[model samples]
Target: MKYDWILFDADETLFHFDALKGMQLMFERKGVNFTEQDFHQYQQVNKPLWVDYQNGNITAEELKHIRFIGWAEKLGTTTAELNTAFLEAMADICTLLPGAKELMDALNGKAKLGIITNGFTELQAIRLERTGMTHYFDQVVISEEVGVAKPDAGIFLHAMERMGNPSKERVLMVGDNPHSDILGGLNFGIETCWLNVHQHERPEGINAHYEVQSLHELRSILLA
Candidate 1:
């Protein structure tokens, strides 16, 4: 293997992250019809909050409760209740991306696998457990618990500590987000692979050591 440790981003890289569907399912359980408009409205608040969270302008707890505040008021519930329900709904629908399992199965026993995600802790555990993907990872680092999100050296440093401080050259970070995943790893002095499945344009001032449109392509590249 080319690398001793392979780190992956959870949402949209290895796992399918369909927030719209998850939100609909969450509201349905509460006997509320969550429409397209409702989801858009939710995103108006949620998206900016994420940017703020990643930029270190807001804490995870603030982002969690603030995004669901309006919905909670309408549903006669607390933001905590709504947030937990949404996570549970997301877990119920958790699924690996195409060829994700094949990649993981192939990599197992060949190299160490780890997940470093900005995704919440509750959703991470349940999703991995529900999808039967728990055992594939040697490390699961959540930004919520680590007190720092990606693009911050602290979180990467934390992951490196848990990884037994492997040589940076022998570790690879694979993720869908160019800013948080690729750039972050690059800044931390490690090789990175951008998983651009949607064929998105490469962002400015950022470059990955490798780029692949699918996990299958990644598997081929890594095992070559």
Candidate 2:
């Protein structure tokens, strides 16, 4: 492997985080059928909250609560209760992305691995354990615990500190988001790989050092 340490984003990079499905499952437990229209409306409130969370303009708690406020009112439940149920539903459905296990297996002995996620603390650990991915990572940094999200250098610095201060040149940050994962690694002076599964156009100035469509492509590049 070219890099000594690999830091990954948890959601779409390693796991399939289907928020709509997870929300539907959550509401199903509450005896409500969450439709696509409901999910669309939820995203209208949730997406911008995620952006605000990443920009450090809001706390994770705030985002969690505010995004579910409408649903909570409709369901006659507290936002916190809805939020916990949503996370639980997400955990129940968690699975590794295609080739995720194979790539990790290929890289396990060759390089050290870690996860730096903007995802909530409640889901990260359980997903790792449930997916049997716990042993593959040496560090798991959640922005909620750090009080900062990705695209910010602070969270990256915190990750590096826990990693015994590995050389920036010898580290690679991989994720699916161009703004957070790519830009954040670039700002922190580390190599970056963007996992653009949807073939989205690269944003204006956020250039990743490498780009691949899937973990298999990444493994080919790294394990060659």
Score each candidate by Cα lDDT: 0.95, 0.95
- Candidate 2 C-alpha lDDT tens digits along 1-224: 68999999999999999999999999898899989998999899899999999999999999989998887888788999998899999999999999999999999989999999999999998999999999999999999999999999999999999999988999999999999999999999999999999999999989899999999999999988
As a TM-score, model 2 comes out at: 0.99
Compute the lDDT of residue 220 as modeled in candidate 1: 99
Model 2, residue 213: displacement in angstroms?
0.3
Residue 36 C-alpha lDDT in model 1: 97
Clashing pairs in 1: none
What does candidate 1's lDDT look like per residue over 107-207, in tens digits? 99999999999999999988888888999999999999999999898999999999999999999999999999999999999999999999999999899
Candidate 2 off by > 4 Å: none
Worst 10 residues of 1 by lDDT: 125-134
